[model samples]
Target: MGGFRSRSESGRTGSGDKGHDKGQDNRKRQGGNRGGGRGGNKGYERRSESHRREHDNARRRIGSGDRVRDIVFEVLRKVSTDAAFANIALPAALREQKIHGRDAAFATELTYGTLRMQGLLDAVIAEAAGRPVDKIDAVVLDALRLGAYQILRTRVDDHAAVDTTVELVKANGEAKASGFTNGVLRTLTRTPAETWESRVTAKVTDPVARLALQTSHPTWIAEAFNAALGGTPDAPATELADALAADDARPVVHLAARPGQMSGEELALVTGGDEGRWSPYAVYLPEGDPGDLDPVRDGLAGVQDEGSQLIALAMLRAEVADDHGRWLDLCSGPGGKTAFLASWAMGDRATVDAVEPAAHRAKLVRTATSGLPARVHEGDGRRLAEIRGLDMPVSPEGDGFDRVLVDAPCTGLGALRRRPEARWRKTPADVAELVPLQKDLLRSALKATRPGGIVVYSTCSPHPAETRDVVRAVADQTGAVIEDATALFPDLVESGTLDSAPFVQLWPHRHGTDAMFFAMLRVTA
Candidate 1:
């Protein structure tokens, strides 16, 4: 997302985060405009009148043309009106607005933070406005979300946050709604975020709903994460809150140093990053534009989640009998895993065939594996077995790939950290809609694998409907043997199992990785 903060600000503890509001900080925030700034109480009546006039005067400063806030508002507007992803939209907005340094950091925080905490922000906005957020105009609501986020969360002075946002609304052609925006934000400034949390969730009685409010997640997402952690609907797992909070936290970038080209330690030293805890090839980027680094630009290494690296690592480690040096990435796109696989496969003189139906993503796969012995095929993965003329080996002993990967597409629930606003964009219906394709892809992968071959089915989601359930049905239907995939990473998955099933679900809280689900299947028939 290109978000950065001063090392000092980044290193500070959570006391400075949302809802803490220390006494010193509050006094600093007020700018001597509220609470006991007067020489005398003046019997409370006069004090209240005096405070209101001064507050209005402060709000009148407008503070317009704040390029940082303007960048954030533009990103939010794109995300709201055009459904643009914040990470993609933010960097472009920053460059187009020519914002950099702390100003860029402020814009990044406001963009990501507001979107990440959108659930809670909208709840507070609703109560303050005495109406549902949907009742407000979309463009106007974007301005309000920005203002409320700054006032309630960041250390931006209350009046500056309000005044700048009122101008932002006017600049966005919502001059009429500027009054409504100002009134709503002024109402919000009266209470601290701690009190507002209680006010927003006062009537929400469900345990899942309460967790959602507390953690700024949609209730269903919290419930889904809870279920993936072994809780039932409306109930929470023991670690549910911790899991959601970890997912809600800002994620550090992980880069995979392409095998045979660079080692993790060498990359870490050169890039000023740290070697990752689990994956041998993983490097944790402390903070910087990875594109500015040589390794990334030269394709010696690429940005990928350590959890994602594990998916390819497990495939490499899985035992395949009479290996034929042929591998298939059944749904490779944006090619992170495919590149990782091809880099490792180079040592064995192996070839990789990648299938991606989208033309644009197919180009990404091609570019990501440019110098590698990988083939890119733009077609549905479900037709892999039927595409007979595609030059794959058919050894009569059992003609199919020795190893197959079905990184099936799903709702991407596990990757909420990278895309802050996605939780609000997803729905239970999305999981339901994707389940059939997930099963179909897994079934195709199993069919495309020869006897004694291994097929790894994975998703960047822990939702049961997309992970264990899909693997279970395909394995049962195909009579494939289920291997305890947790054994592949015994040190990483200390629990040895997920809900006692022979599958691995790496979580953000437990592994500090995306909630990736892995199931390794062996074809015995």
Candidate 2:
């Protein structure tokens, strides 16, 4: 949902050229001897000439002056130096660079692959630099890391990686360090990346820590994932390892066909995507940018995660017999969910009031829900009562909507693959700060819902503190009953039943969607 699909599948799977090892291929080719005859000598000479020509062709393909690497450097600088998000910064750069076909694909691969493996790359860089990576100039380090990424992760010829990287460094006025950069990269490429993985992770005996290095995740996040996946006694080492690998894998783009606008089947046909198996209105994005698609640009459908579409649809599908037909989106920003909910409500002759604190995000919500019966209020959701003033009327039973969605903000660990640099930006302290606010938002959403109404609390995170713990706290304080939400999507659930009581958490490894957590709290009097 609003995710990327790269042309070259480098680093998309955690296996990064592992199955197609160039070294192993060369060994296989050189292992046997040719029969010793003059004719055989001639045959050997012909084969060697052909190999030389092939090598030269590969070198020519890696030639310079493409300007694609420049686009990549600019994005890396914005993300690393300016603390920008890859998802937001990349598109703008691609447009500004005017790169389309194979060049765009190469830029996408280098930028994302380098960022995804930044931690492991840094570890390798530090070992190769003979000092901490921090000791190098920031600009020089970024150039080196980009080079090292191609050498280690991608199938780019090693000579091309080092040569192009040195050229980039020189272009950026780091010519003095070009020799140092070239030496380090050559040393790195001398052995396979898997060998370096073994060397760097050899001393780390803890399963979580070792997995963190192997999977290119922060150690804390690795531990959090392990704990969330039923740690130690219940789940095994392989479970946590698979989850980590999934977090680093590339996520497919998902589109939500807004109700009353377009059908999922029609949208799939127009965009060449397949209809999603989970949500009725969901479509899996085909390759290339969704922005270029007519249906998306026309707002007939918008990019949204299937897991997110499922949760929003679940709130709608909940068995609410009140017939009160009113909806609210508390903390709706960048309004993907609000747009879907509002379109559905429009079909039912209902209305939706979306609350977004930030002005820019509120404007985005307005843009997303344009031409629908949705109102955007720019104010903090914690002040829900004050913000939803007398301008909007409430239900006759009480001062609240019949159905409310609280997509609270929290550590977005569930979407690490989509947001390549987010894993480095988040910390345990961020989770601590967010847990209280998440609970407060849920409480306010519950307070604003009428008795017998349904309030759905959701987050794009699998951390227990931000999900089940928050739901448990609010339910305990308010006496709200948890509905069996997994029943809403029988196809996505494991047992085709709602056995995991109280809340539903979707896993990327198992569900091919962001690890979205959902809880349906019925305001029972």
Candidate 3:
């Protein structure tokens, strides 16, 4: 019967089956049925779905300039009208807009750059714009600022800059005003404004005023740094200009391994570098996705700066011995240093209590120390001495903590590279305003520490009023002995006069790190 079967029947039973099997094999090769089991099909479907979503997201971001501009405009409007801090509002805007990658980078540059050069851009706009810049509608003013930044500073082509900015105005229901924006930007392109120096020299008579205007810094701040550097004839201009023009680049992300939780070698695998020479627990990484590293993702290590790690290590070394005792971080908020202190105190019988005045900022302290063991208190540091006196269990041996860190809040002059807007916003009055608070905080931190215990006062600023002056006044008022931080970190310290009163001042112009100030004081019996 098989031999007598028709050709169609033979084909269906043999060739037809082979053809069907080949088709299935090809489908499997194309990732259609490679996951053949029930579980495999579900997994394959999920991965394929994720890829399609990612593709769609990329497509959405491609022509997202208008949306980005609108969001940025809203942020700028809020900052101007509501007196919002641009740093705080910009992040929220970016998150709300769901902007990422190149779009995020562009928005960041546009917003920050426009704000940073607002004074100059406004002056130019005032000249080019027919209406007074301030008198123009807020939205229109922002449009002009954005357009001015592109035309004057960025490499964006003149026509695109004008057209995009005009489109932004038109989209906001100012279709009639597009011609106005167009004409102003066209005139601006034809005659770009002179450099900041020319404008400063033309406007200001005093050299300090000229420097401040040119650099976009407050004149008083320029004067303060000048005085702090011993008032050299040219020091004011040099230091002020350097501070303002210093690397506006984003800071490097640093990582430190938690004791027992991770080793420096382990962090090295994450940061792609060996442990820092000055700080064995510190790992330096060039900017990248920190979440990609297993140790970071697992919370075995944290992102911290080498300088901050060094500061914490310096405090640890300042203790007469590595014996376990209570440690306090006064004014610990957005707690980067407090986290390091917790890691350093991990194995020892040492315990750390980080105090932050603001509830929200205190939450940051808790979050930073989440993986580590540390006690976070949300209260005024000024009252901490009394509170701890009541709550802390007194050892039969003596008083409270073995060491204290009063990282006082100040004008963040040293961290301008990290906070680009800060250089322009800070004034000498801001420095003056912080001195009393710093003094109070220092006195409280000193009172909280046991006799013979160390208190390290630190600020991410180079201002004398916030640094040497505060330390000097405190040392004169109390029986605290000044210790030389440079003597402790010889490799990191710059050669300077010890008569400068035994403090460490790291300058960005000199040292590679943020301009940090440190003073180690010890209370004597």
Ranked candidates (TM-score, high to low): 1, 2, 3
lDDT of each: 0.82, 0.80, 0.70
Writing each residue's lDDT as its tens digit, candidate 1 over 26-65 gives 6455545544745543445476667666654554354257
Model 2 lDDT per residue over 222-277, tens place: 88777777775334446677888887687999998998889999999999999987
Superposed model 2: Cα runs more than 4 Å off: 1-66, 233-237, 388-397, 494-500
Looking at model 1, residue 352 earns an lDDT score of 93
Which predicted model would earn the best lDDT? 1
Report backbone clashes per prediction: 0, 0, 1
**TM-scores vs. true structure, each candidate:** 0.86, 0.84, 0.77
Worst ten in a row by lDDT for model 3: 1-10
Instruction: Superpose all Cα atoms of candidate 2 onto the true structure and report the RMSD in Å to 1 decimal.
Output: 12.3
Best by TM-score: 1
